[model samples]
Target: MQTTDPQGSVPSDVPEPPPHADEPRKLEARLTDADRVYRAVVSSGAAATLLLITLIGVFLLIGAWPALKEAGFSFLTEKVWTPDGQPPRFGVAAMMFGTFVSAVVAMAITVPVAVCTSLFINEYAPRAVRRSLTSLVDLMAAIPSLIFAIWGLFFLVPALAPIEDWVVAQFGGWLPLAEASATGGSLFNAGLIVACMTIPITTSIIREVLAQAPRHECEGALALGGTRWGMITSVVLPFGKGGIIGGSMLGLGRALGETLAATLILSIAFEIKPRILENGGITVASGIAIEFRDAKEMGLSALMAAGLALFIVTFAINFLAAMVVSRSRSGAST
Candidate 1:
């Protein structure tokens, strides 16, 4: 039975609930003066960066307007870039083709080597040697583009000429791509140089992503009697798939924009050449660099138009890469 208190209310053993049981706890951070200042500074910096990018795009558009107005849709379709001719019959089709082909070739070479190097460095190397290897890759990334161009022109081209000739001779009959002359200044050699330039940055990004793969998942795979290669295949590779794509796209963008190396290594041709092994091809960036020095009024505008095209392509590539990364497991911040 229940007992009554002095006021005749029934009493039980249960204690009264605390004052506001249903009210949610406030989780908001208390901002200090320093915190507020830091937030404001960071916000301004981000805004500034966006604004700067917008300004650059606006400038490119303004500068390219005259050429685009004159050339109309033909700017993209026509291959001949005789800007010096009356009415300026210029277009980016051939240069764009060369850019894509060389970039594709570079990616084909870069991706495998980068993945293997990253995996070996992250999963197989001794901890003592890992840092050194990583630093070496970073150093390679820091090397100037001009130096790579000079090296390709003087040494790499000569070294690759014999190999190029042999490959062409072996496969030329069966493969149209291999039917062209295997000269020193071909897109093939330029692609090789671009591949070397791309490898370091790609390896660095992939290595970091692979290193971030869930440790427990990897161990679980190994515990399930999986071999090292099997564990990596099942765990690390899946986790880093987005990063690999992102790195490859980034490398492709770099290859497309690489001016000095392409300019130095390629003998520029205005016509579309599907055969990358040929001695002459021109990328958009290389064309711009080569033509800029002697360009007059309309020619300069035409070059700006070309620059606009390249800028759009690179911007799209990077934006796509960012989207892929943001949707990937490795991109999660916490």
Candidate 2:
């Protein structure tokens, strides 16, 4: 008989070994050529922005070099500005002081109103009302600076004169701004005008940024039984701090470069006074705008130097804003 196995199973060829437990892991590839090109393009665009800023600085410096070399460092500290006589003495102290004081006054006036308006829009107003009000603010922003100057000169100045007189009567003895407005135009007037000019921009930007704050963070604050003010102060502000700073800086930049409005409203005298309502002070931009028509040769160069100084200040403010934004982003990521 054939001796066949009871279980007539076919024999297996072999058993495969299991995958190794300690094999080196492979990583996904980083990027393709197209992706690299795209990244390079983006980087180049960013570099181009910096390059443009550098070029502007270089151009400004080149244009102002004659005055800069002639005046040396004393140009910054000197208070008198002649610009017409022989050798044409030009000092930036009065202009610089005027610029800073007007800007400060504008910021002081703008910050409170802008912040409050933004808060009301974000937290208090109905959706319909908020939309309408926001549109109005945007419209205000579209109004030309020259128009604002005209309004300030023709309308606001007259309207504010009585108020100015009241202020002078109230504090004239203690402060110089109250020393009587010889022509009804003062640094205070310019500052108030600038405040009006900056309000729409600051309020709109701040409202938009505050609106972008993390909803969940605000909700969490509410859930913790926090009042609306408490939630805003603790959560919303901290979250939107960077944007607030950016908006303020943007307003400051506007204030620094404002020419027509301040020039129209300010007295443009060379006298530098500590009083906000003083009549004699003038800003760099206003100085340039007012005198550029008459300026020639050395006078033109000196005015350009003033312009360069304003440019540097505005650039520095914007740079600080960028750095703040970057740091805020980094902190958020962590």
Best-performing candidate as measured by lDDT: 1
Best model per TM-score: 1
- In candidate 2, which residue ranges exceed 4 Å CA deviation? 1-33, 176-178, 181-183, 325-334
In candidate 2, what are the lDDT values of residues 73-146, reduced to their tens digit? 98898777776668678888989888988888888988888888999999989988999999999899989988
- Per-prediction tally of clashes: 0, 0
Please provide, for model 1 over 1-334, each residue's C-alpha lDDT reduced to its tens digit, 9 standing for 90 to 100. 4678899864867454457767785555559999999999999999999999889889989999999999999999988887877868999998888888888888999999999999999989999999999999989989988888899899988888888888889888889888776577888888889988999898888888789889999999999999999999998998888889888887888998988888999998887866778799899999999999988888899999999999998998888788877787463543
Instruction: Output the lDDT of residue 113, model 1.
Output: 96
**Cα shift from native, residue 215, model 1 (Å):** 1.7
My TM-score estimates for the predictions, one after another, are 0.88, 0.84
